[model samples]
Target: MTEGVEQLYFHRARGLTVTGSAATAIAARDGRVLAAAAEVGAGRLVVVGGGELSALPFLGRADNARFLLNTLSWLLTGQYAPAGSELAKAVTHERCFTVRSFHPEEDLAKVEGSHVVDARPYRSLLERIGGGILPDPYQEQAAFLLEAELRFDEMPRVIREAVTTFRHRSNDYEGLLVRGLPVDAELPGTPADPARRLDKSTWLSELWLAGFASALGFPLAYHQEKHGLLFQNVAPTPHNAANLSSESSAILLDFHTETAFHPHMPDFLMLHCLRSDHDGIAKTIMASVRMALPHVSLADRCELFLPQFRTGVDYSFGSANGVQGNGPTLPVLYGNPYDPYMTFDLDLMVGETPHAQQALEALRSAVNKVQRWVRLEPGDLLIVNNRRAVHARSEFSARFDGRDRWLQRVCLVSDPVPSAADRRGSGRVVETVFAV
Candidate 1:
């Protein structure tokens, strides 16, 4: 093993030198010397060379590869090691159902008694808008007038109540299926059938605007043209159908934090399940690094803080997305002293330092420790704290039976951010997924 290591090191060194690049190489007798050859940038490129690479045993080679990569990463990014900082001492979990449900009767009473327009009606109004029906023109105008007179403060109160109730228990994900929001009783705006059109103005007036804004405050941010809501449909395309039928098994998607490439990433992501897997096999997996932190070693934590890592894009979005490549290594955790943030992607991140490799392994182990699997059903909504957790999905078959899995995903950036201005300036709502 020793002989092979020596030979391999020499071979890599020679490769670097032969390419006329200045690099660090260890001689058999002289030990280690840093040599400078400039091609791409200023620095001694370290090269480990040898045909003995093939002879190196699996474990040894793995270590060597990790070490070399981490080193290179550090050289390129000029960042420090990971600190494995602890973020929240304890996260609060609240279930949505436990919160005060939006009640129209109660709200109506308040408005009648106090001369205020009840916002609860707005929830029903949104349902009508989303249902794609035209409401009575006069009723719609009146509903809008009522909504305009209603106090905006009440809207936030309702949203806060809902959010406070739905924060997850122990885990980082939270969920709530908001029901009873009035849907438009009316059918399509233009219809051959008149019966489809019903009185939907009230539903649209109260529910739609409130729901959209509420989503912005708690889990969804209204980041115009930058990042906000995402709409996806399970169309009957051959590719989608093929994905449904062939990938039904629990296929492991490498763990990743969403949109690491983007400058502004979502703090939370909500996926509303409109349909479930036909075979009931697909499960979404989430791993909290905070939960995994205790398992990491102190030394590994230091390495992780080092700026020797690079993140490639994830695969959901194709390659032509114009994302930054081979950027500097960012620490896995950072933020307030008490509440640290996280950035990680096992598949897209490359560590180029020995310490960074150690940190990566430690983080990997920690993530595995707290991994949670959730299988979603129709109407089941999952809200993930994107900054605090990494998530992936287990592949499931989609039988092409029109009953294939379907989900509605929306990304949100929470409080203390510039949301209203961003949304007003840009019409872009959906967050872009990076390609790996």
Candidate 2:
């Protein structure tokens, strides 16, 4: 059972009987057993009084999802039982955790399924936000963001529903691509460098990104990256063409979880493409841990949960200027064992031991085996759950001209209170010092 989870909203609950000697009353309501767990002959059993506990509406009310996930982990491995109990003591003392890592080969076929939202019908409604005039995205003004949040409900039901689904079901897919979103009628030329700021005449694309991010979570920024600009420009630049950053085009951008080493890393990283590459082949590659885990060996999966890996900060965050220190040693995978979260970067993360290195390589191989490529076109917005997937880009030719591939990036966090100490007066920017 999850601690501090005293209130749970359920549609209808029934009474449960704990008849076995090994049974434990994990939960109760008005002295009536609402949930129970028992150790059978060679297996474990968990029973809930309500079938709607896993339903979406019920999950939104309290820590139902966490409770269910904890219950699942307990039943699968016999760990995370009621603290201070005999089962909990034995589980903790032994540390004999088991992972159900075996999965059918056909599961890969189902994991590649796409969740696309056709935004063609919502163009008119999107254009009305900000009184049809969008303010400068870099300006530290809260009015536009508040307006975007208020107007998010006015969007088409399909768009709103997609956002809600993406928010709730964090393990369903790695990314979501919304197509046919409104863009500027007369778009400005693509900036030639990351530092070059374009004078945008219209804010259709910006508004769409902000509105969608606001609806999902609080849009965030980093003082160390892009000077705390809420909206960052992702385009090929001559200086960064040969580097390992987002501005590079000549070199393949290695797979990475956005800000993987930082404590307050964004939960969702969104990219809205205003212009595509000249050849239209610069694919955005993504591989989810959910799909890749089944391909990994059980031993390697267990090793991935060990604290034998360290990650370095990205160069874009001033890593070259003595800020290139590696983060604290951490496990590559954590959370629910069956469906876990990951933090990985092919270039920045390194292993501390020989077996750990092998485990990391195994993870790389599994991710490559199930990687998917997406070619983003104009009016396409891609939202990725940073914790569940690692993303990269295929190498492409970049002229560094005004028409090169251009995309606007935004970061989001599910909740902002965790970074309250890093932010200034309800601002969206999180300080880098605190993040380190």
RMSD of each: 17.0, 10.1
Model 1, TM vs. native: 0.50
Supply every candidate's count of residue pairs whose N, Cα or C atoms clash at under 3 angstroms. Answer: 59, 0
Candidate 1: residue 351 lDDT (0-100): 72
TM-score of each: 0.50, 0.73
Q: Candidate 2 — worst ten consecutive residues by lDDT sum?
A: 89-98
Clashes of 2: 0
